[model samples]
Target: MGLWDKIKDGLTTDKGEVAEDAQSQADNAAAKAKEAQDKADAAKKDAGQPDAPAAPAPPAPEAPEAPQARPADEHKPKRKPHREYTVVSGDTLSEIGARFGVDWHDIARINDIPNPDLIYPGQVFKIPNK
Candidate 1:
């Protein structure tokens, strides 16, 4: 009976050791699988080919454009003569127009006045070139 009990105790101890060894092996396998996945990711990055395409390089800066030459006539417009007149006391549209050698109707039209007889003292009027 003593030998039988010793044999049963040895068998129980061996079973426990076997379970521990199996658990250790499983942990090592999991660690190795993680290391392999990390190495594969690093290799993909080093190859410069990711899951998505790389962004395109920005376009090269454009060169400044040269100034264009224009014709001489483009700088000159048709010239018109302008005259300045100052209003005096008791001045009317007829008197101002006669003094400037222009018709009262022409004066009123050029100055954009609603009433030809509404000229007042101290107002300046522009007489247009005929």
Candidate 2:
């Protein structure tokens, strides 16, 4: 039976019967949809086209290895001191300061810049340590 006709008939039945009927119809609809999808997949295979994309393959297992011991005296290399930065085209004091992890005002003060907004290309500015 058609969906609307089934629903109309359900409205005239007992509430419990109506709910059961609706559940049955929904289950049938789901079954039909799954069947249609299976047929489509088969048709695509017959036509030499790829089926719907599949779930990704699981990642490969990792190899278990013993951790290597390090010498106690070994330490991370120290960061080199930042001294100067030559301004390039489109280089701003704020951007240069950000690259060196310092404030633009500090860079301008250290470089004795007269106008903070008047920096030009090839002008070198001193970068202060953070």
Candidate 3:
């Protein structure tokens, strides 16, 4: 038999093995994507909390309520710092740094990107200092 025919025959026999491997890889990728999507959905839900409402408009001056004092050293939960920015058109490392009042080197280090020039539009970058 010719080389082409022999190769085709081998491939035909191995097709199942190749298909199984491809399917396994696809399943793994799909699972990972689902996990990432779930995390994103959870974050969105957490960010949309309605428990905290904006402060009411300043009321006219009135008699203050009796102060209910607490311990001077009482510990309260620290608020998580916000640190994310999306890349937009006409955006550069220097420009973003200037806008956020941070150094370009710090931004690059926080993102772990070797090349700042490689960032593209729609890519979200972490604005560190958390």
Output the number of the TM-score-best candidate. Answer: 3
TM-scores, in order shown? 0.37, 0.37, 0.39
TM-score of 2: 0.37
Arrange candidates by lDDT, highest first: which order? 2, 1, 3
Q: What's model 2's overall lDDT? A: 0.85
Model 1: lDDT equals 0.81
**Pairs clashing in candidate 1?**
none
| lDDT, candidate 3, 10-81, per-residue tens | 778567888999999999999997787677667767999443222447879998899989977567766546
lDDT by residue (1-130, candidate 2, tens digit) is 8999999987787789879999999999999988988898899999999997544578999889889999775687766565878999898889988898899988988788988888899897778777
lDDT of 1 by residue, 34-67 (tens): 7877777678889985633334478999999989
The regions of model 2 sitting more than 4 angstroms off are: 1-82
Q: Model 3 residue 59 lDDT?
A: 75
The 10-residue segment with the lowest total lDDT in model 2: 73-82
Shift of residue 36 alpha carbon in model 3, Å: 65
Query: Model 2: how large is the Cα RMSD against the reference?
Result: 13.0
**What global local distance difference test value does model 3 have?**
0.80
Whose lDDT is higher: candidate 1's or candidate 2's? 2
